[model samples]
Target: MKNILKVLRAERDWSQAVLGEKLNVSRQTINALEKGRYDPSLPLAFKISRLFERAIEEIFEDDKGEENA
Candidate 1:
């Protein structure tokens, strides 16, 4: 997945640690998410959605042309 997490955080002038604190996660987790090295769980996704006041789809996107069997 590709997400606009970094952009959103930047827009708000939030550090990774600040975002992590708001999301109840670690700074490393936020960094991983921003770097696309990890995917968030459903609950975490909802938390992010609520925090940003944006729909999950607006924040996270499924890579196109990828299909599951």
Candidate 2:
């Protein structure tokens, strides 16, 4: 999955560790998320959405292509 997590964090002047702290995850997890090395679980996605006050769809996109839509 591709996401604007890095952009969002940058907008808020938040470091990876700060974001991880907010999400109750590790800095490495945040790094992976920002780098698209890992996709967030549904629960984690929700947490991220809630934290940013943005819908999940607004933050993350289906990099596999939106052909289904």
Considering every candidate listed, which one attains the maximal lDDT? 2
Model 2's TM-score against the true structure: 0.93
Minimal lDDT window, size 10, model 1? 60-69
lDDT of 2: 0.96
Candidate topping TM-score: 2
What does the lDDT come to for candidate 1? 0.95
Q: What is the TM-score of each candidate against the true structure?
A: 0.91, 0.93
lDDT of 2 by residue, 1-69 (tens): 899999999999999999999999999999999989999999999999999999999999996767776
Summarize candidate 1's per-residue lDDT along 8-30 as a digit string, tens digits.
Answer: 99999999999999999999999
Which residue pairs in model 1 clash with each other? none
Off by over 4 Å in 2: 65-69
